[model samples]
Target: MAKSERDHQKVEAAKAVVYIYINHLAYHISPETAVLYFYQLMWDRLTPECLPVRDALTVVIEDEQFKEEQGLQFINRSYYSICNPWHLDNKKRPYLKQIIDRLDREPETESINRTTQALREQWMNFSKGEYGDCLRRQMHLGGHEIFREEDREFRNVLADYLPDYFYLYRSVTRTPDIEQLEQEHSHPEYSGTATKQINRLRESYDAVYEYRNLRQQGVTGIDHPSRLELAEFEKGLDFYYPGRNDSFKSKARTICHKKRRYEKYASYRPQVKEYLMESVELFPARTKSKLTESIDRALVRFDDRTSMDPITSKSLFLGLLDSVLLPVPNTSNILRLERCVGDVGPMNFTGMLLSLVLACPMIRFRLEKKLGYLYRKFEGKSLEGIQWVVDLFEHINLALVMNARKIGYFSLTEPLPDAA
Candidate 1:
């Protein structure tokens, strides 16, 4: 066969795979699970050879081809694509970013659009049958209901001990079996410490159950004593077990110290705002307005900075760059940074810094200056005392070093001008 024919055959096979996958997803799982899970399933199935096909499918799905043809809407489609777990691996970042960049550059010109449209139409027609109707009904009921029967049986077995079981399960220590606890507490060998611990657990369980019951009975404003009960139980543990409570006390002290530091730090936000305003001139003319606007917005949103922890505070600052500087052009690329940093918890500060450099190359020095000041204040502090600040310092240093290396490489490898 000719090379062109072979290539055509490959394309046709990919389309078949995509069409089968989409139909299976739309009919079986899409409505039952969250869109993120659907994306996860797709990512798991997409091998290197299938990546181009996946990209094509992304365009088709995001462009609302299925919705337009079948009147089926996909909620949070952009989030599912951008925050797809597959994108988290650094190795996959460049490939996914390239696809995203190309899509942004030419969204209207997907070569496979016609093929995708035909596949979608076929899916819609096939899904209009009785079998499809049954699948749709099941999807509408959702996965939760499917497992509810099993859950109910399990819950019934622990009806009286649900609160205790839940508290133990959520605790840092090993969870004791409810049945075993009943049996062991009755045993003659049960020690005083074990008895006390079990009693404390029961007290906590009662307090929580009572609180929840009152809430269910429309008793709002009733103070919940579960936390206080648990704290007392923890205190008992400290009293009974030497050195067992030291870690807890140290953690509590650190939290209290952090709270004090944050209160002091918050007082300097006005100064930080003024500093940022002055540094706006450091940004290019095109980005200066947006950068200033972003600063103002962040200040307004996080006026009560003391309410947030150090990690949260840093994330909010990075979120400003994510919103203002990153010209990701489309929802998909927007998700790239959001999934990386947004509400997902503490990201690698280095990655955050690199992304900022990529988005706003001119702001690197300004970021360095601001972050350096913050770092110096916490430099000699204990790891627990300044972990967030340390992360910020790493972000700045990595960004600067990476940017410098790039610049150095370009300067050394500058090509000679071609002879006219």
Candidate 2:
């Protein structure tokens, strides 16, 4: 099949999976928890550049303070019987059988360290060679993994910022066109502190996105970036700006051009420090009038803003997002699992915080390392109380996918061509 046809099929498959969970499986478990499992399965099935055995062994012996224990467990117990490949009589495990067959074809040899290196070499070669095509297809068509069957309550007092499952499921079934999907990713049901802040962020990011596009199209004078220039450029566009004043034009120029001005005055900089402050301020009011006052106490480490990159800034943003519910500011260790509880519970609050973070186009994929850190930290814990963290991870996964759609990597909304 053509690549576009294959892509269409892949997306259709994903949508079907979403439909099954929302309509059937969700009747038994929390839809939020199921999304967590969806992301876990996708990661387990898709990312095996080297030997699965090697990865499992690495996690077991990994010196990294924050290793994801569930990574190995989820793959072994769910994907296939990788632990005992020779006992592969099960037709359900074709993927496992293929891996063993590949190993069988390798030259007969054995060594303590050399054998280990050989398996690594074999997987590397296999993943980069023609077999790689099969791997991608197999990933999408892989057998179902076990799902957590019980519904769980959140540990903290989290407000319900998510749409009802019925509405969310209905929305998924009626997947909109790519254009509409991009424009209305936010749901009306979500109007928590984080949601409101994210909406503000979306406005700022939209302007930045437009400014970047205009510059790339060879719009002159914006190369140096000034509101005066952007205002003149805007006059030609279809968008209406009620106040076409100098400061409004100048503010646009600042946001698009001052990408790395994180200093003492960084708090006032557009789309950088200022955006961070606005998002952070959405935290519930506590003793100091702003709950973020505690969070910013930890920002002292980031004082040397001169060397800070977008990743660091993103880390800071998500850290504060995670800490929004904290009784005290401990941004040093975000997602403070032990202290994640509130009267309403942590699930909805964290989910809302994550939704807001994903609204900003700039930080969409810029903070993967931070996310991986949180996943590792939360892995192996009971899903009964902390399912929210898993739910949070899935939100990140959805955010990343939407980011890809925005950039046109693939499409779920492509209409089938007219039949011949």
Q: Which candidate gets the maximum lDDT versus the true structure?
A: 1
lDDT of each: 0.37, 0.35
Model 1, span 1-420: residue lDDT tens:
998677555544544555555444433443334233343433232334346556655444444344552223221222223322222233333333332232222122223456444434433443453223222221111122222443223422212122222112111111123223334557422222223333333344345446545766888767654222344423322332212344322332333344433464466456545534543454445455655676677666555645555555455456555454333345454344233333222223333344344333344433533332332333335555433433333333322322332212122333422210
Q: After superposition, how far is residue 13 of candidate 2 from its true place, in Å?
A: 42
Cα RMSD to the true fold for all candidates: 25.6, 19.8
What TM-score do all the candidates reach, one by one?
0.22, 0.32
After the best TM-score superposition of candidate 1, give how far the Cα of residue 236 lies from its true spot, in angstroms. 59
- Where in model 2 is the C-alpha error above 4 Å? 1-97, 100-264, 267-274, 277-282, 286-291, 294-335, 341-366, 373-382, 394-420
Poorest stretch of ten by lDDT in candidate 2: 158-167
- Compared with the true structure, the alpha-carbon lDDT of candidate 2 equals 0.35
- Predicted structure 2, TM vs. truth: 0.32
Among all windows of 10 consecutive residues in model 1, the one with the lowest summed lDDT is 166-175
Q: Write model 2 residue lDDT over 1-420, tens digit each, in one string.
A: 898676555544543443343223223444344334433322222222324433443332222221233222222222221212212222424433344234234443343453343434434444344233222222211121211122223333211212111112112111123213324645322212122223323333344446656766888654322122344334322121212353222333444355453433244223444534543344445422343454565355464434445666555555554445332334544545334334223333433443334333344332433443443344345555655554454333333322333322222344322211
